[model samples]
Every structure is written in C-alpha cells, then in structure tokens.
Target: MPADTPTPDEVWALLTHLVIDTRDQWKRAVTERTGLPFSRIRVLRRLRPGPKTVKELAHAAAMDAPAATVTVNHLEELGLVAREIDPANRRQKQVSITAAGRTVLNTALATPDPAPASITALSNEELRALHEILGKLQH
Candidate 1:
C-alpha cells in the first residue's frame, strides 16, 4: 500500500463491495440448504430476535412495506410464521416465528459447514480486524 495512493473514501468503496459479495455468498448457501428463497430466509432470520410489525421488518430487511407483507403472507401459509395483534396498537399486527420456523432455522444452522477450512482458520485478531474495518465502512 502506498501512502500517496487514493483517499480513504476510495478504499471504503472497495471494502463495501467485498463485504456485500461475502454476504451474498452466505445468503446463497443458506437458500440452497433450506430450499427457501434468500428474501424469505432473511425475513425469518430478522424475526429470530423477536416479533416485529410488518413496517419494522420491512425497514430492517431493506424492503418496502408492501413487499414485506407479501413475503410474510407466504411464510404464514407455510405454517412457519404467525401474526399477533399488537397489544400497544389494536389495529396493528406483529409477525412472529413459530416453532416450525425455529426448527427450520436450527436445521439450517446445523447443516455442515460448506465453506472452506481457510475461513475457519482465521485467528481472533484477524476476525476482529475485519469486523472493525467493516464497521468503519458501514458508518
């Protein structure tokens, strides 16, 4: 690396591409293992933390509210997710993952590592450095 090279912003763009590419690959692997589309898997994964309104899920998943609702409807049909009336807002509903959904997520997690040993070989320091660098890029 040359000190007189491109500015930090240029390096940040490259770093963003690298991170996105890696995430896309991981999403693809999860989709293949679960037989669920990447979008659906992402929605379910977001709900793992807790139930969320359709609007909240949409924002978290970086999708429009209408699209998120449609996806939630499909998952509902599969018996993987359900909607509950929001206690705070009687007119609103919150989506939550069912036991079946948890089962599917657990199975996906249990799937043997399809990634190469090189990924597993990274030391804690290297992993922390990558995380910190990505965090900076995100901000």
Candidate 2:
C-alpha cells in the first residue's frame, strides 16, 4: 500500500464514517450542554449569517419545508429563534436566531472536548494536505 496508490474505496469509506461519527458525537455533546435538541442547534447555526425563509433554511439544512416549520416553531417557543414577516414577500416569513440563540451557540462552541487536542496534533502541512484533498471531493 504505497502512499500514492491508496485505495479510493477505502479512503471514501473512512471519510464517510469520520463525518457521520463526528456529527453524531458533536450533536450529542451540544445537546447535553445546551438542553436543546440537535436539530434546533443546527437551525440556529444556519441562521447565524442572516435571516432566511423557512424554505431556504430547509433546503440548506436538507430538511423538508414542513419539517423546518415544525422545528422553527419549537425553537421559537424556546426563545432561541424568531420569525419575521418577509418585507419583500408579505406571505413569506423569515427566521433568524435571537440573542438567546447566539448565546447558546457560543456556549456550545466553548464547551470542553478532549478530542480536538488530539486532532490538532497534526502538523500544519498535514492539515493543509487534508483540506486540499477534501476540497476536491465537494464537486
């Protein structure tokens, strides 16, 4: 198994597993710390940039519009998010993370984790290589 001749299937499988496991673990940790469902946290993170309509958020989050609406409703109940009338489209509503949501996001990010230190041990060059390789797969 030479470095240049690594098996593509093996690489893809490893990457896939890493992604799923990382997401599940991170979601569990965030939910434990914030007492908010992982789905709600995801919705809040997506809204951090700016307000987005339910349809937009659903598409971005890979969820259906109806599901997004339900999640948004729950988040709204928790005071973590808000819905505003879309000025451009009177019938449409846009969602945004409230100040409370921002605080939750910050707390989630600040929560201690022992895994990151091990991950950070990789040299800058190795990280750059990994990033470059991963970036090529997005297409």
Candidate 3:
C-alpha cells in the first residue's frame, strides 16, 4: 500500500457506482427516444441476432418466464416482434424482432451519450490503460 493508491474495496465501490450511473443514464435516454420500456428494449436486443424461445428471452432479460411472456406480448401487439411456436418444441413460443423492431433498435442505440468531463479529461494512454484493466477483469 501506497498512500496514493485506492484499496481494492474503495476501487470496487467507485467502479460499481460509475457503472450503475452510466447504465441508468443511457437506459432512460434509449427508452424515451424509442418509446419502449427498458425491458422491451432488452428483449429486442436479444432477438436481433435470431429468434429465441420465451425462456431464453427471460434469461437474457433477467426476468421470470411470466414477465418475459408479458413483455413479448406487448412487443407483438406493437408489431415490434413476432411470436411463433418453436418447431423443436411445439408448446414453446419462440420470439423474434420484426423489421420495425430493427429500425427502433438502431434508433435507440444511435442515441449518443456525451462524454462526461472525467472521461474527456483522460489522455489516450490513460484510456488505453483503463480499458486494459477492465478487459482483464472481464476475463
């Protein structure tokens, strides 16, 4: 311990706080701009690549099966998603985003977040170093 360095606990606290703050910021902006709730946006994002059963969507969206069904139902009514019976399992409902959903997803994601002063103040070297550290933690 160098006096100038933050202890691990202090670093974790700061990192989690910043992550939550940043997530909340864009979550709100995207929801407002796309006129879709965050849950719907998440469900749409998960379906962008391909269709998934409602159970899969529930796992990806961090919700229970019932909630996922409700969300998918709303998206379907809005023409944002299409639901079909999974061929492999006739009883399971598979959901996929519609063409209009792609448009909304793009529009929602394209909404930019202005860099906060703290980030803007960092030098390229600092940014790279921070990126490297975060990448390590992810692994």
- Each model's TM-score? 0.72, 0.75, 0.81
Give lDDT per model, in order. 0.85, 0.86, 0.90
Per-residue CA lDDT of candidate 3, range 12-128, in tens?
999887777767778899989998898888889999989999899999889999999899999999999998888999987789999999999899889887766677899999999
Q: What is candidate 2's CA lDDT for residue 48?
A: 92
Which residue runs does candidate 1 get wrong by more than 4 Å? Answer: 1-8, 110-139
Give the per-residue lDDT digits (tens) of candidate 2, residues 14-72: 87776666666777888899998888778888999999999999998889999999999
Measured on C-alpha atoms, candidate 1 has an lDDT of 0.85
RMSD of each: 4.3, 4.0, 2.8
Strongest candidate by TM-score: 3
- Poorest 10 consecutive residues by lDDT, candidate 1: 111-120
TM-score-better candidate, 2 vs 3: 3
Candidate 2 runs further than 4 Å off: 1-12, 116-139
Please, what's the RMSD in Å of model 1? 4.3
For candidate 1, write residues 1-139 as lDDT tens digits.
7888998899879767656656666667777888888888778889999999999999999999999999999999998899999999989999999999988787666656453445467899987887788697688
